[model samples]
Target: MSKEQGRTWDTSLFKRVFSFTKPYGGLLAIILTIITVLAILGPLRIALIDHMVHHFIEAKDLAGLRTFALIIVGILLGETFLNFATTYLSQKLGQSIVKDLRNQLFSHITKLRLKFFDKNPIGMLVTRAVSDMETVAQIFSQGFLSIIGDILVLVFALTMMFVINWQLAFIVLIPIPLLIIATNIFKKAIKKSFQDVRKEVSALNTFVQERITGMALVKVFGRSKREAKTFSEINNRHKKANIRSIWAYSIFFPVVEILSGLSLGLLILYTLSRVDDPGVNFGELAGQLTAFIMFINMIYRPIRMLADKFNTLQMGLVGAERVFKILDTDELIPNTGKVIKHDFKGGLSFKNVWFAYNNEDYVLKNLNFEVEAGETVAFVGATGAGKTSIINLLGRFYEFQKGSIEIDGEDIRDIELNLLRDNISVVLQDVFLYSGSIYDNVTLGNPEISKEQVVEAAKLVGAHEFIDRLPDGYDFNVKERGGLLSVGQRQLIAFIRAYVYQPKILILDEATSSIDSESEMLIQNAIDKLTKGRTSIVIAHRLSTIKNANKIIVLEKGEIIEMGSHAELLQQEDGAYRKLYETQFDGHEV
Candidate 1:
């Protein structure tokens, strides 16, 4: 059982769920009115039957019987129409609220910082946005309003039974207290079961999603049997959770049926005792007994369903609480800067910078660097030497703990987040392409970028030759993550995408590290054209790639030990850059 199952009906959460209905107030009022009328019609039909039996059927008046039967039939038709309207309108209201809530949830997630995604799993989020939202919809369509209609029916039925014959009504209600106690027990048990079911469902989704995405790795490592066994275990847990709810239902429903039967038996025994009364008319008494039986059935029908509806309401409230927790998160990157510059100069400087993924265990310690506008600066370091961390800090994907990063002498924090990112583009080693046509991927659904502009950018970056070789040229569809394309081909597409944006600053992080010699040559030529006039930052494992850079900075343990041109740095016999170059090209340790 979840912690939330211990609490009573959360009135504030209930109010929050209903608040989404404010936009459809008129429709809700109409649904309520229909439900009330439907409630009245149920008992009214029973009264009509009792009256016809006493006035027409008992007297053997056939003509009056025919007329009264038609009247009841007409009321039945109207009641049916009202039932249909209430069902249709309530579902419409529920779906509308779900749509709005999902939109808000998705929008809020998009604005959250990257750190949030790093900490949360994508499959858990997918369950919250999709399945949980559907559960919340049931609070309107199947849970709350249906329970209200059922209660109103009970109220009218009870009032009519007492008005016709008070003594019989009292006898029929003798077993109701026991039924109420049973219902309360059922509600608590079922609610705990539902909470378990929801938790298991989230776990199931997360496990399946991760395994499917990593299927290739599992097969390559020959762990298929192991993964299959793990999946079966998760599947069994989900099955067990649902079985718990089924167990509660199996016991509770039978108990309701038994109590309802006991109430009918009590009513019949009491009526038999009053049959020989001197003042009572047999016909009138028989009609009253019949009407009371109908009333008992009507009352017990809703009572039997009340436990199930209450469980649905509880589950929806649980789902809402989970979704609201995410919506309430305060981890969004602040975008309060008012500065917007159309022609941004890409001179960058970092002074006394310190950063870490967590706490003060810094990855880059007191780092300092400067890049003049339109200068190409290269950074060479081993893995985990704070290379990618610099790109993340510059884009404000993560925050730095100390010191300042400035662009064109203005602090990056003072610049609008979107505007600052718009002026820079980074092409990483692992390129991600959405499932769409090449044209769509290149433009990324932006209306401002024309097909001609995309074509021009492709030609400039030498990507047009391969793209033109495809059957559909720019119209070719690239499946998920560009799985159909080779590594070099995908890199070429990334270069074209970056070039089309015409960013003032360009970042290439291991862009040429994984490809054939021919593809690397093509990308190298494309890189020369791309960085000709833009401020560029290059991170490379290969020492030959950055020989022409204006300045080469060698970093070891997050601090720069050497900075100069390639020849100048090589001239120093003990320099880090000289040693790294010799290890790669001369095939020896220095």
Candidate 2:
């Protein structure tokens, strides 16, 4: 893929992330309050140590010293308990925020129109749902919480140090501006590096998934060596990006360490010069020294944390952008229509419909067709002759640009999408079986159905016989995408799925194309029973399968050039249907 065609996570990411917190405003507020308390305790500990050195040590009072030691121990224990509590609360809040994000993202993506999926691969979408959602979860789960604590601590430490001794604070802070500038510069470079790393990662993910899916083809073609080389090239790019990121951090962390160390050395030199002139007390010197060292240690950590988070944040932001990109896709066909809640009484008509994938060119143009209640109409055409497109339109997968589709007497545009789809069942050319028991896959179409109903549906589709042949029968576990089953068996299961729905309208888009002769015959009989009292639109390649269809429409290019019963079209001289029949049946008995 070209760089121009692919995209990284977008830049305007913070606003999107912060928006997720809106729904969980209450939990976030409590988390913030705990964070603020944690921050204030930063300077409080330093100040306590300073006071112990100056007052207790100078007074040479063992009793006072003992009391101070006890106070220090108590503060340590309190902070320990507070740390655990705050951590628990932050985790709970983070998980809540991520759950809300995942829910919104899931709902939004599922509602996106088909054209979105047409262009985006299933692998990329899987990345968004799994990897991207996990990334966002981590950002909220740990990164944001840590950042909050760091920011607050930095703020309190800076303020208290300045108040304690103005001159020393000014001298110590000289390195602060330089450190900030260095970190900001490092941040941009590292963010870009990590962004490159993430892009390469997604590319690798896409590449591996695509190859695994095409493994059979690759093995047959003997192209494993070439494919491995290609994979290695991509993997190496990812490696380089990771190495560069590590190098950037290596330079950045040690630089922070040195700058912070230098600040301490300068502060000590300045304090020593003052002590001789003012005849400073030993205990007072020790007190100031302890406070200064603690403040310097505090400064370096938050700086490093602030810098490091950008690495995680940028990667997560890019992931989030991809997820949101899918969510933000426009609906190609909006449902401004009324909900089709009541069962459809079948009558479906397409009035002079002109449809196109890109909307500019025609796949089906000015086409007019209608199926009466309980009619079984077959669309038989050569590949890419707009046969499947007809089924797509019937299922409301795509809307016509130049004409209207009506169901029963009402325009389909006026029907709520779910309500319209509720009474329609589509069996596509591709039979996707999930990794689960036979019963799980069959009943997936309508889980509320009874066990007996599932078995009945399976028997009707001729799936039960082979299902029973399996080790666990209906409970047989299918591997990934039902790879464990033969293609024909999978198709039979898909048939059972469609039949179980008992939809008002049935769409069979080459549904029987993958199965064997025996299974196909069984599927044909099942279809005959299933479509007994329903409207069925079938697009089939096997001319024999549609021989019994009540009406047959043959398309050439984007228009229907011929139409009649199987017998009527057969009798026409060199009719389009006759040519199709001759091609398929001439080679093999139809």
Candidate 3:
């Protein structure tokens, strides 16, 4: 949920993560088989060492020594082959799981309601979808199978040591409990540090993404120094988190080396004292001693690295917790009924609507309105008068409480969401263009809209005049967010995009607010052609823009204060519309 929450790995979490590997059952089985064989070879390798020393070297058996050396080489080669296979399969498994998760996250996010995006930062979501999922991938690559193989090797090595010489084996294991205590302490500390690392990474990502998106503002206001200072603080936190993890590693590994040496010392001391005993053949015991030393390395190496691997496992679990939390969030706009098709007559009504973004803090209160088919209606109001909220409600971008919205005398809730939205199109003031060619942006990559239709729609919006001047004409690339295009040019593209949809209802939300007067005049005729014989709702701050509307509704604090034709509203004695026209339009002809 948050950085403050527990990040410890639990059995249930492991089970959940392991479930993702089920699709690769055949590959996972092969990996497990390789680990089992490698584990079984652990004791056999030590036994071979004993044979080569006592029977071949000490007894001077030349042919036997040659044979034993060959067997050792063969074993080494076979182990190498199995290790390669294991590494290859582990990587494949990790990548496959990450691919599935990325697709699912992208699909889920695309379908989520706009309200969800309002609450979560884009940088945080990107971190979860990209970086956090990579941590999950590590659970397969370095965390799960590798740990299992190390443990199996340790288990087999210990079994062989006891079988060879129980007394010496018991002496060699004296430091085990101490090693365990140290490892557990290291694990707890590193888990917290790793969690801190991930938290700092996410915070740093959010800060950088926001600052970069607003670089123009920073430069305009001369706030570069202040912004850089803030970024430095976040980057420093990230560095400290990494250093804390390094401190944990610095303390843990050397302690493991010390305990390993202690074990070796005790084994050597016991073997030397038993050297002269008649029951103990000195040569054979020395070989067993050599094998026992190798066993110590084989055993403790895994034990020591297990703390680090367990830290990876813990970080992965925390990432999963964040990822699944978003996947489990119930923020989707429910699609209940399915209506395949509707011939909407462009009628719309909002009956006694009361709404709020936050609980009970209404932005739209008791709003009642209706529009007949094929009428051009304009909503005029000051900022924060809930003008855009009405458009958002009609498009079903949000749900309202204690009211019903209808289309063509049918409750909009009864209509399928896609079908309802398909019949209405909105052109916002801030037009957003995707990174693509002009034709792609106009048709929005819809296969059903032909190239000829896209050109026709652009001609209607008068966008083709400027578009034809570009080097590639219709194929000219509008790079990221259409940065290469002017605001007026981008708005013209929006008009074409909306026109290509051919909707029954068209909404222009301050659509020409940012455009130059010449561009606005060019688009005015296109707007006249696009809205003819269709229900059009226009929201504008400029009084001159909506003067020709069939009806104008004046709003104040979410209530309809005046409704009439433009001339009728202006004729009222000291009316709100007349006052707004005087204050906003001044000398501009209307």
Q: TM-score per candidate, in order?
A: 0.95, 0.93, 0.95
| Residue lDDT tens for model 1, 1-590 | 34696786899988998999999999999999999999999999988888888788888889999988998999899999999998999899889998999999999998888889999998899999988998899898889999999999999999998898888889999999999999999898888888888888898889888888787799999999999899899889889889989999999889888988898899889889888989978778778878888888899999989989988987888888888889999888788876876568789999999988888888898888899999999999889888888988898988889999999988888899999988899989998899888888887888999999999999988899889999899999998888889999899889988988889899999999999899998999989999999999999998778889998888877777788898899999988888889889894432
Give the RMSD in angstroms, all C-alphas superposed, for model 1: 2.2
Which residue window of length 10 is worst by lDDT in model 1? Answer: 581-590
Candidate scoring better on lDDT of 1 and 2: 1
Which residue pairs come into collision in candidate 2? 9-318, 337-414, 338-414, 338-416
Summing lDDT over every window of 10 consecutive residues in candidate 2, give the lowest-scoring window. Answer: 1-10
**Candidate 3, residues 86-204: lDDT per residue as tens digits?**
88888888889888877888888887888898999988998999899999888888888888988999889888988887887899889999999999999988887888889889998
Expressed as tens digits, the lDDT of each residue in 282-373 for candidate 2 is 78778878898889999788888787775566556666777777777776468776665666798888899999989579999888888898
Find the candidate with the highest lDDT and give its number: 1
Off by over 4 Å in 3: 1-7, 587-590
Candidate 3: what lDDT? 0.87
lDDT of 2: 0.81
Winner on TM-score between 2 and 3 is 3
lDDT-sorted candidate list, best first: 1, 3, 2
Off-target runs (Cα >4 Å) in candidate 2 are: 1-13, 138-145, 587-590
As a whole number from 0 to 100, the lDDT of residue 513 in candidate 1 is 97
